[model samples]
Target: MDVSQVLRMNGGDGDYSYSNNSLLQREVITMTKPIIEDSLTNLYCDMNFPKTLIMADLGCSSGPNTLLVASELVKSIDKIRLELGNSNEPIEIQIYLNDLPHNDFNTIFHSVPKFQKKLTKQMTSYSSSPRCYVSGVPGSFYTRLFLNRSIHFIYSSYSLMWLSKVPEMINTNKGNIYMSRTSPPSVIKAYHEQFQRDFMTFLKCRSEEMVRGGRMVLTLLGRQSDDPCSKECCYVWDLLALSLNDMVSKGLIEEEKVDSFNIPQYTPSSKEVSNEVEKEGSFMIDCLEVSQVNWDASTDHNPIFSKEDAQGYNMGKCMRAVAEPLVLSHFGESIIEGVFERYTNNIKMSMSKEKTKLINVTVSMTRNG
Candidate 1:
């Protein structure tokens, strides 16, 4: 149940190469822009109109999304500058992009030159001098990742729900065999416990790292309801089970091994998220919203796959990428490739029939005095 181990199963490298689908890019950019603007305004207010500020993009993956986040920040800064008027004093803007130690730092760094050029082009409209610095600080978000009170604004996307490791309970022999995806009572409880522990730690660490009144915006996957045992929950453990079943039937995996495998828990409710923040007593909630991500957009456009292959492949690949580590560790690597292949084909088939989507939860908060 080690979450890091599961993450490593997907090639251990942090460079998750994603295709640049214009529609998907636009969707994420639109979702984040308002939150970024609101957080910046609150941060500016908290700073009492400071001429300079610092911001960090926590859990920033190497992709077009990074540039989108930076663009949003620059626009926010421009709005602030327009309100303040031109002055001899230059505004100091420091931006830190953070992620796991194993992430592709080279790709992220290589993109900086292009980002700077883009920033320069965008800033031409503004008359005032603004000094901006962007750098990478690699580490886990559960621990202190920055200097104390150094950040004014923080943004993280689609990354927070991943606990540092899998829940310990799931690893024990007494744990239910179906704990990974099924809504077993013991499995649900164990997941909740781990989530609370990890989330509280996140709040405590951020509280210490952020200056009083600093603002943060986070968007990640979440459940529709607060109930932990609901069948129609956010993480869709059943779908995973279905995909695993396909693998077992193909003789790529043993049925007995699949019985003991557990999918890492997700689907944290808004109430759960709020309670964690309040417990920390340092952050004031500004906004919380949940929306669906168009995960099946590609499928809707593709007509090549057979129905069965389409359904199995699209969902299977999406889930297996995250679940493969668990499968490999428990069942061995001999059958993993075929299992994944079947699952991917299934997902593709599913996608051919209808569009698929991912549920997302967004929370915006500011430090309280």
Candidate 2:
């Protein structure tokens, strides 16, 4: 499948929009704030208070989360400038918020006015007001999106795991939308190889576009083990697969269609990420932190809690916001409601049996000459 055409989060600011259901992704972004701050600080020092800052937020799905990143970068720069008592020269900041063409760029664009006003109010108290320009760049990150040596810093969160396309040899991965315990050995190898190629391409592209010593911070779901079928990597997709089977049983979806479909996503282990970086030979790793958040952590304000009455339906809504476009592209519109109903029930059942958390890997890197 042409994932670039089909793989998009539910768009717009409606109840099921990515903007509303992406709290989990926001938490992931929050977890990487310190690394991002450090990267910006280092860039400032290395560049000697550069007058212009060019950056991009890859896989930046719409909503407050996209604006949150812009806010953080501007704030970090302001903080650094204030601490150093830098010259009164004005700094111009340009941010390219990037996602697939199908992403809800309109929602992000519409928020730009309010975002700028909020930034203006906050900056009135500060000594300097940085000129910040935010715009959406539509394309696949797997390809070049910027000119060579243009971007000074790059940030991505909860997005790198999506492959440009499904693996070619996935025909053997029947009854599973992702790598699973029952997947054949060839199926596992196909996924691993695909991730390696896609990740290398990502590094290579960034390396070309970024100046020497530039920093890039990325956060995405990952497995703690090399096992492609590890719980941390596949459990969520396994539940979805189970839900699809239930749909098949009830005559809601065709069994052959379910078997034929596979999500073009792969959560790699930290070692796998490190190996690819080292192999690419363009960037040096600064930090590779592994963190975990509960599956239902997006249900409320708090990201942590003892299992109370699990909000399984809410959790399913969050996942649907992310996975719906892909499913709709594959299974058509007929089974959408029934599929999610079964999927939400599966989430509830699994949470009752045991609590589970998704492992996230945040890697900070600096471009090397």
Q: Write one digit per residue (lDDT tens) for candidate 1, span 1-369.
A: 555434422432332123222234347658778777877876776677777788888877565667678767876777766676634445778888887775556666777888877777777454464667888987888899888987888888767877776565544422223334334566667778888998899888988889888998987767676665544354245455666687667776667676556555566777888888888788999999877766543232337766455444444544554556567777777877776665565555545566656666789998887
> Which regions in candidate 2 have their CA more than 4 angstroms from the true location?
124-127, 301-310
Backbone clash pairs in model 1 (N, Cα, C under 3 Å; residues 3+ apart or in different chains), count: 23
Error of 2 at 230 (Å): 0.8
C-alpha lDDT of all candidate models, in order: 0.67, 0.87
Give Cα distance to truth, residue 131, candidate 2, Å: 1.1
Number of the predicted model whose TM-score against the real structure is largest: 2
Candidate number with greatest lDDT = 2
